[model samples]
Target: MMSFLPQLSLPLPHHCSSSKPFQNPTVIALRSPTTVSNATTDSGIQFRRKLLYLRGLNVNALEALRKNPEFRSTPLRTLKSVETCLASMGIERAALGRIFDMYPQLLTCDPYLDLYPVFGFLLNDVEIPFPDVRTAIIRCPRLLICGVDDQLMPTLWFLRKLGFVGRQAITCQTTVLLVSSVENTLLRKLEYLRSLGLSCSEVANMVLRSPGLLTFSIENNYRPKVEYFLREMKGDIVEIKRFPQYFSFSLERKIKPRHKLLLDHGFSMSLSDMLKVSDGEFNLRLTKLRLRCLEEFPSAEVLLLNNLFLISVLTPKDWKRESSISCFYLYQLPLLDVFVYWLKILGCVNPLIVLDFYTFPILQFSSIIFIFLKCS
Candidate 1:
């Protein structure tokens, strides 16, 4: 049987002791329709009205607007001006959804006053075409937020000094430097480039070629790579000027290993070919080197494994470590039933490819020795 809860009585004032059971006055007050009306504010009501005026925003955007102090307090005239500004620019009605979704502050800020000069300077003063101007503004909405004299002009002048006068596609890569602060990013990076023993003109040329270099950390990326190239690779300032993209590639990953491998093999590859190519392209170049070796030794123990890799990947007992790494990466193996091809290749006695035994990165170098000895 269920235990019944005991009902206790307490004395109450004559006004409160009614026939109906008592409820909390505060609870009743809280649940009132007027209380809800009070909580729903003038700013809140205006925010909803603003949402209605703006086309294509959903419930999620409405919730964001409610919490946004700047957007919530935006004046009617300013909101009207933003709408007018977008219209004056050829920003299609459908595009406003995306534009506003990212930057609601655009609605309050006077775009005609704030943004016009930026567009004007880029298009007319710099002679950046209308299409490029449109692309820069739309692609990076932050372009609207950047000040003309303070942020935008200085960045343009810096880029102009680097010889970027009229060539204005405003690529995603270049736009990053354009929007970044001057004292910290643009000016500081200029100083670091100068420290690399480059004249102002050479530095400007380097910047023009590889705008992304400015973004690299002086300590982490620029200095370490420069030191390695100077001390290890014996590179000169002129050599760095020829290929500033050297700094873009990883020092530990691409530069050090590839340069060492080329020197060891007596194969002289350019900085561009070595650091720039995809893994497949790099392998192809190595295969070409292997073929050159085959010509040097007609009965060479080394075999060319397709046009992508060297025979050492499949043939050499000593190169089992390299072979295992290759097998893991050579994804151009059969799309369907990939592991099955390895079995067929290993079974062949002529030009034996027995290193294909393991699928996972094989640490066991014994496989190579065992296969070769058994074949002999």
Candidate 2:
């Protein structure tokens, strides 16, 4: 055709010289299994790195990949959808890293199929408010991984039967209780409290009042505190029933130190008063007790009643009103020295008297001086 078309020149196969079309070197390289595998590995690594960076996870990406193999095969769009689902539920971006690090399986969960059911149970069944759903999840990240039908629903039913209903219903603060196993954990704790002589109603009230009570380990928390309270502190079980929060205090750090200090000073306080005050306030109370000279005369009320002259001076009205006057005010009277001096001069050598200024309605000091002079 002039032979119109030019003769085509193509590289022949080294082995077969068949009439097969030549493939581009670039295309051949791209189609190689080794090259494809390397590309896929690189893409997966890049995706994992991106996930780590986006979630603020301070972890080794390779370790996470190894721990969660499913995460490697999951497509990026699917992961983004999971992130979006959590974000829509009020979970902060920063918390996602911790949550994912703790529960890497969450990374591959189908947002609708696996995740929404949990949120639904928390909202509808548990009655956790929409805003507090984030709090419940953050407080117990395991809640996200818990199965709705198997774990959560059963736990809710158990708690309600144990009296976590009505005004004493579970709240965001107590959502951690949802993760406890009814048989191994929750019921065992309840039974232990019952073994302490608490009725079912009483145990329920205690747990309702202090939700952390159910979380305490009997071997670690309950037994030690109860032993100290009974054997060392000589406290009654009734006190524990009244103040179940008593177990919440640390034995070594708080309860022991404070109780030891009180015993050292021969002072006694109710459980609530002893453990509830700040360290500074407790020390201040002890100081004031010392200043009042209460340690020297522990029976000041009885001693005051036995003093005939002091009793005679107190009119019926004054006697009735004296009950309102605190012993602190009685000891810190402004003219206490003058009263003591007058009493000493009147043949009362040891005058440990407690007087209130308002005990004499007309003239405070005048009435005391008149009474002492008239007696002399």
Candidate 3:
């Protein structure tokens, strides 16, 4: 067979028969074996790298991380320190998976500063019982994210101020302190309750009883409801102190309707009874006091006060004519007293206030109701 390919032999340069065969530049370069070896090594590395995103980074724990519900999704920037942080805290893999389930974000936090400091504070400063520390962390993970100086210490100090100050105070208060804020929550609620006439001791007892109240907002949750209790509902400080749960009830849903109903019927239900009753019970109590009684059961004469009655409703112009004092000019005691007797047996105060007609206006009616309910 005829060879069609060029040979690597000495066809020698035609012009100079003795000239050595010319070497191809490509072959000459290939002839330097180290270059071929280096090129092969470089290409092999490139191919290997392209096979995997993070080449040469051994993650024997990658399979375990797959079991972590959150760590796999955790941003690399945060995941780098998460396991180390968890391990430094002596958190085993089994427990860490559960922790991540609840607080996946904790995995991304700084292990040394953000993490150990918080753990140290809980274990050392606040002295959260070591056994209970896990439960507390499970309950509230922000201990990892929040700084001890700014967020945590202030809250601890406030909790201490709240009468968690005794030797057992830290143990008693650590859980709730981790859950709330000092400036935004605990402090504001304390100040507002004090403003509501809760004495220092009373406020302390209320907070110790229900730490969640401190989490309620001052402007939205605490203030408006408190104003309604004190100003509109005419509730006594003692009433709420006696029943601190008053802070928990929804104003729109519970307090307003019951209060307005009682006021319109001239009844004065105790604040505790007013807020605590279920809607069904409240409606049942209200139904017993007929709508007709609101307007039709006019105030009878004060003489019949003990008979569960009062005088008929009279216009302001005609009040002087029908006024118990006017009708019974023969009475020794004041008409207000007689009317007070009129509504007491009937379990309402409106008729008495109404009996004064123009004398006792809305605010005055509230005052009389307040004084009467409190005194009663």
RMSD in angstroms, all models?
Answer: 15.6, 12.3, 17.1
lDDT of 1 by residue, 100-152 (tens): 76776666676767767767766665565666665666777787777878887
TM-score of each: 0.58, 0.68, 0.47
As for model 2, its CA RMSD to the true structure in angstroms is 12.3
> Lowest-scoring 10 consecutive residues by lDDT in candidate 2?
367-376
Query: Which model scores highest in TM-score?
Result: 2
Rank the candidate models, highest TM-score first.
2, 1, 3
Return the number of clashes found in candidate 3. 5
Model 1 lDDT, full chain set: 0.63
lDDT per residue as tens, model 2, 210-288: 8899889999999999999999999999899999999899999999998987887677999999989777677657655
> How far does residue 149 in candidate 3 sit from its true spot (Å)?
3.6
Which residue runs does candidate 1 get wrong by more than 4 Å?
A: 1-45, 49-68, 75-84, 92-104, 166-177, 180-182, 227-237, 250-268, 295-376
Instruction: Give the C-alpha lDDT of model 2.
Output: 0.73
How well is each residue in 236-291 modelled by candidate 3, as lDDT tens digits? 77877777787788899888887887777677777777777776567546644542
- For lDDT, candidate 1 versus 2, the one ahead is 2
